[model samples]
Target chain A: MQELGSFLEVLISGLLAGVLYSLVALGFVLIFKASGVFNFAQGAMVLLAGLALVRALDFLTRLGFPGWLAIMLGFVFAALVMALCAFLVQRYVLGPLINQNALTMFMATIGATFVIEGVAQFVFGSEVYPLRLFPTDAWIAAEATFPGGILINKLDVWGGVIAGLLVIALALFFQYTKTGRALRAVADDHAAAQSVGIPIDWIWFVVWLVAGLVALVAAAIWGTKLGVQFSITFLALKALPVLIIGGFTSVPGAIIGGLIVGAGEKVAEVYLGPFIGGGIEYWFAYVLALAVLMVRPQGLYGEKIIERI
Target chain B: MGQFKTSYAKDMVIFPIRQDRIGVYLLLGFALVLLPLMMAFHVPPFRTDYFLLAILLPFLILSLAAIGVNILVGYCGQISLGSGAFMAIGAYMAYKFGTGISEIGLPPLPIVFAILLGGLSAAFFGVLFGLPSLRIKGLYLAVATLAAQFFFDWVFLRVKWFTNYAPSGSVSAPELKFFGYLVATPVEKYMVALIFVIVFALIAKNLVRGNIGRQWMAIRDMDIAAELMGIRPLVAKLSAFAVSSFIIGVAGALWAFLRLGTWEPLAFDINRSLELLFMVIIGGLGSILGSFLGAAFILIVPIFLTVLPAELGIPITTGTVSHLQNVIFGGMICCILIKEPLGFARLWQIGKEKLRMWPFPY
Candidate 1:
């Protein structure tokens, strides 16, 4: 009974972790679909956004604003800053390089990631800051009878709820809006969409803006959960494996990949760890996906096109 | 100019010009012989020799790997994120082989052979990963390679057999030597690396200029046309992977033998892989000279940043220094890309062109 309870706890923690991973993957998918460039900076963007949000809140408090109002103001101001970053990236960095190859564009994104991480460090010193996403008193106590009891954090539950709502909101925005429709059209075929007079440039910019917002939302939740640190950017590397398993183009794949990798790593660590000295289970998720990739190269939902000479 | 009156035979020469060939020969001879002598004479503790062997050996290893990758990525148009993992395979394989042989009282030559063999094993993995390139395009292929990186890193770290069932879960190279010359010394180690790099780089240059290289370039420029032109995509890609893996594996062995001498799996972690890939990308793809230039830029700039600030009495904190280094390094990449997206090689070519007309404005 104790073993069963521990397994259940591991599984639940993995699912919550998966939700955050999915959020980061979603940012990659948005920019990839619109611009066809993998935003290598997405991970760093998460770190920068979270740091900015914390700074905004702190700045407001220093100016004598109430705590709650300060927090709210921080959220809005951070979003605006992210949007501006998107616009500048598209206008100056990406727009000029539109004629360049994918490798060049990818290198540019890497450059962006390094530059952002540095600027963030400069702006907000390299210190881990705790983020208060919600009230500390918001707790729900539930007890389950087993051989031994397990303790679960109430805040983890809130993180799940907020992440779910955010995912749904994003899904609706992408599915319903005119911008979303155009974005999909461009993703499907850039040249054909351009021939039909869609403003390809603006679509890329807006989609990148949306990706930044997605990053902001993920960062806030994750930052609050883990505490904000410069090393948090490495966590974003976790999303790449998810992206690979989920299929680069599918939103549903991100969610599924997240759950599989998250739960997979936890279970492996708990069950198979003693066999090989343990901590390597952190990388086991990726090994599992590699096997999966050998079977399904285009990913689960990615388009299957056989190239002919 | 009797040299200018040279026949088509002279024009078609591999070195084309005599002075250039002499320069190349002199440079190679110096690297192979002179570097070892210099290292033997010098013993400034915590100074140049240590920097050259400790840091530069790994950078050279990464450069060789990047060159291998450049053949596939820059020249052949396939993107990969798995170079570091392939390197890990070489490192671990060398460790396993060296230790296994030493247990039987075998010499270091067998270990050297084992490291190359280790690289061949990584090439096998590369082919397995490259199989996806037959179906996927661009970013998809890159992601597939990234999966390989993660998988190999996990397996090597987790599997006890790879680490010789070590308690610490980390592996180290056995003390290596060549012809009874202790290779553990910085000078000896640097010469070993210098020799290997020059030889492999020449081989890579030859491969790129040969028929196989042309076939890879054909595939890169336009796969459909290459396919139509009777080139098999599978053969071209897999061969590129094999060659790339072989070079990367050798570099990985050198990294183990020379650089860390002792390291955990994280030494060849994803960050290292990305850094190497960036070295190739920022340096220039598809150019042999770019491999060296990129390695120099990526490796030397950070050192320069670290020392230059201190020399000026800035007294920058290590954290701030590293952060600033990251920013400046990244910014320089952006600036280089923006100014000449073709990379540093092209910039060098442009400089050469300008130099020919240097005395008076054209």
Candidate 2:
């Protein structure tokens, strides 16, 4: 009973953690889908967004604004920052090198990553800033069913709820909005979309802006959970595996993939950790992703890639 | 003088121009004979051993690894984030061979042999991880290589057996005795690396100019077309992986043996892999000269940056220095990619061409 109870606790936490990973992976998917770019700077964007928001939130609250008002104002400031970043990146950095090969663009993003990281840290000091947006305490929901009630983190539940809502909103935007339709068309076939009178550059800017906003959402949850720091960039490492598991183009795939990775790594760390030196979560997620790649290179939900000479 | 190449043999010569050959000879002479003599005579810049130990040694070793990366990425068009893993394999494997396990009654191998063996092991792992390339392409392949990176990182860090049960996790290089001549001095150590780099670089240059090199380039250009045109993708890709890893492994072995006397697994992480990739891109992808150029630029520029600030009497914190380096390098990479995708090597070629045609133009 004790073993099962502990396993249940690990499983729930893993699923919740998976949502956070999905949030980061979601940003990668949006850019990759629209621009055909493997944006290495996505991690840096998250850090930037988190920094912009947290610093703003801190300032606004210190000025004696109400808690809710300060949070909303922080979101607005971060969104503006992200919008500026998108315009510059999509307009300047990615604008000129439009038709270059994937490899070149990828390298450029890595370069962009350094620039973003430098600017973000330079503007907002490199010290860790605590964000108490979400409650960090836990709730035990099932005392009668198990020996010890399953320890559920209140923060994880809030993060999960926020992520779910964002996904629903993004799906609606994609399915219903004209701009979203244009974004999909561009993603499906860039030349065709452009031929059909879509503004290729403008659409790319929009996609990036949306990705940046998604990153803001991720920053909020992740910031509150871990206290925003440079270490947040490491989230890119975690998100890459999720990107592999969930197809790079699928929103639901990101969520499910995150869940699988979260649960899988948590279970492995708890059970298989002692035998093989612990901290297996990082590589364990990657190895799992590698296995999935072997079986299905396009991932669980990615469209099948057809090649022609 | 430009019309002297009358035959195929003349055209195929490594340095087709007489002036180029003379220039290369002069450069080699300086590196081999003049540089050391200058240090011995206590020249201003060469007065301190810091130039030899800190800058030149790392530059040479990194150039060797960059050459390896250039072979795979620049020439063959296969992106790998696992060079760090291959380097780790080379380092750990060399250490394992250099200091044999007592339980197996195996005497420690010669340092040269151990280094070669380490390179061979890295090449083997390279081929293994490279299997995914057959199925995936582009970004997928790049991300997939991270599996190797993370896995090897864990193995070296956690596996107690690899460290020879040393109380401290860090492993120290054994004595670098080449047939009983101990490389005890910093100059001797530099000499070993310089020789290793020159030999391997020449070999890499020759290999890339050969038939196999053409095949790798063909696959890189378009695998399907190359396959239809009779260059086997499997063989070409795998051979690229093997050769690239072999060179990188040697660099890793040399790095462990020469540069870092005492080191830990953390030394060869993802950042190291990224740095090697940076050398390949910022230097020149397919050009041998580009690898050396890129390695020097990545390494030497930071020193200049650090020195310039202090020389100006600006008291800068170390963290700011590092962050500044990142911003400058990152900005340079972007600017280079946007304006001149071919990199510094291309710039070098353009300058030489212009110089050849100076004082006149069409």
Candidate 3:
């Protein structure tokens, strides 16, 4: 019973961590669905957004702004930075190479990743900063008559709730908005959408902005949890396995995949890590995703790929 | 503009044109005579700058690895981000075989034999990781291969047997001997690397031009169509993986033994894989010459960046230099992709064509 209780606690924490992973994966799904380009720079964007927010908050607080106002301004600044990034990416990258092969576009994004990371490090400086969105001393726990009590970090719970809200907000945005429908139309058929007088470029810019906003939220939550640092970029890589496990085009798939990967890695680390000298969490998600990929090439909920010669 | 070949034999040679053959011979002659010529001439930079010689061996090794990656990504159209893992396997395996550190009391093998064995070991792992390629492809295949990178990193770092129970998880190269001569000096190392580069590059060139190369290319262009045309995807894809890994493995052995001499698992991390991929992309995909060009670009640019600020009478911190290098390198890659996706190899071809059409308006 004690073991089971501890397991439940670990599982709960893992599920919360998975919510943040879902947030990052959400950015990838939005961009991929709208643009048909896998944005490798999303990781760098996360780092950039977090760095921007942290620096802005620090600056605003230094200027005698109240804590709440400073935090709000920081978020506003992050949103603006993301909007600028979307504009720049569309203007400089996607605009010129509009009809290139997917591989070429992928490579271009890698180049953009390097550029973004360099710029972020240069501008923000490579120092770990504490981004305390919530008080660190607070804990939320369920009172249960187990051998040891289960303790949950309130920050993690809040992260999960906010992430859930963001996912719902995005889903509704895509479902109800006219712009969202047009975006879907463009994703379904680029040329057909263009012929119908829908501005493809404008839709792309909007999608990138949405992805950028998602990146900001992910970065904020993740950065607050584990101090804003360069290593936060790697957390974005953790989302790739999630993206693969969930379908690349499906938003819900990203959420489910993140939860599975997060919980799976935690469980494996707790149970199987001892036998394997621990640190198996690094590759467990990937191995699991690979196994699933072998069975379903398009992924669990990905649209079926059709190829005609 | 050029002499016509009278016989099919003359036309069938690797370099049919007399001038083209002469150019290649001259290039080889220059490479063979370079060190001796520098020594005789008492060249100040060559004598004083150890960095120049030091960079050469790794450049050659990385070029060879780039060729391996080119085979998979460029020829077979299968993107693999696990080249570093194959390299790690090669390096560790070579260390084991050369040092006789295995469970079996194996005699210390010759350096060449050990390196080949190391390459074979990497090839074995390559085939194992490549099993998913039969089912998945493109970016999916890339992620699958990434599993190899992470798994091997964990193995080399955690498994003490691979490191011979070294406390630091680092290994030094065993003495490299070839035909009773110890390869220790920079010149000797350069010669070893050069010979390997030439031999393997020729092999890659021939492989890509021949029947098997065509089969790999067919699979690359369209696997289903290739399969329909009686070409086996299994054979083509696996062989590409095998051959590519073998070459990459040998390059890894050279990198450990000839270049670094003492190294840890971190040397062949994901960053190294990305750098190798960048070399292939910048050099030219599906072109052997592009590998060399790309390697030269990747290797020399950093040196140039490092030296430029110092020469310009400006004092700059190393951190700032590296930051600037990253920005410039990233911008260059983006520019290259947007402007000339074919990369430097295609530019060279165009230059050659222009030269051939010199003195004519057309």
Candidate 3 wrong stretches, greater than 4 Å:
A138-140, B5-12
Q: Name the docking class for model 1.
A: medium
- The CA lDDT at A292 in model 2 is 93
Better of 1 and 3 by DockQ: 3
Q: TM-score of every model?
A: 0.89, 0.98, 0.97
Query: DockQ, per-model, please?
Result: 0.51, 0.77, 0.68
Give Cα-based local distance difference scores for all models.
0.79, 0.91, 0.87
lDDT of 2 by residue, A1-309 (tens): 878899999999999999999999999999988888988898999999999999999999999999999999999999999999999898778999987888889989999898888888888878899988888999997889898789999999998999999999999998999999999999888889999999999999999999999999999889999999999998988999999999988889999999999999999999999888898986999999989999999899988888997
Give candidate 2's error at residue A78 in angstroms. 1.2
Tell me the TM-score for chain B of model 3: 0.95
Off by over 4 Å in 1: A1-8, A62-64, A135-152, A191-198, A272-277, A304-309, B2-13, B32-51, B54-59, B101-111, B357-362
Q: Residue B264 in model 1: shift from native, Å? A: 2.2
lDDT order, best first, reads 2, 3, 1
Better of 1 and 3 by TM-score: 3
User: How would the docking of model 2 be graded?
Assistant: medium
The top-ranked prediction according to TM-score is 2
